[model samples]
Target: MLCDNERGVSLGTVGLKVLTSKDAKKVYAGIVAAGLRAKETVLETAEKVQASASDVLAEAQEINEARNEEIFEENK
Candidate 1:
């Protein structure tokens, strides 16, 4: 249902829409787009974290190799 003429508005889940305006539907779509963008940002942050973890693991492996070589020389 639409709002009363006195209010000039409609109920929206995340954003307001003018009751009689052309973009009332657009208003709802914009709210949905905002939600999608927020979700996309979370996914992007997760990808960066995975990349950082892989880099750290690679560095640790190189250090282990050097340490193993040093231990072998000492034993010899």
Candidate 2:
């Protein structure tokens, strides 16, 4: 028997048991929905990671600029 959970319906019994048309449709829909949710999460996480990387790069550039200015002043 297939189990239902908070995440989604289980598909573990797909090949183990024979399913009716209605049950098959439900399984297909669940799979599609899960796939879409996964894609959205990936995109969201990627955006966050990209933004963080940009911030780190900007900070590094600022630090390098400050060090260069200090060296220039010391030489003068």
- After superposition on all C-alphas, the RMSD of every candidate to the true structure, in Å, is 6.9, 9.5
lDDT of each residue in 1-76, candidate 1, tens digit only: 5557534533352244354466787787889999999999999999999999999999999999999999999999
Q: For model 1, what is the C-alpha lDDT against the true structure?
A: 0.82
For model 1, the superposed segments whose C-alpha errors exceed 4 Å read: 1-24
> What is the TM-score of each predicted model, taking all chains together?
0.62, 0.71
**lDDT string, candidate 2, 1-76, tens digits:** 4346622434435543556567887998999999999999999999999999999999999999999999999999
The local lDDT score (0 to 100) that residue 53 gets in candidate 2 is 100
Judged by whole-model lDDT over C-alpha atoms, candidate 2 comes out at: 0.84
Backbone steric clashes in candidate 1, count: 0
Candidate no. 1 TM-score: 0.62
Cα lDDT listed for each candidate: 0.82, 0.84
Clashing pairs in 1: none
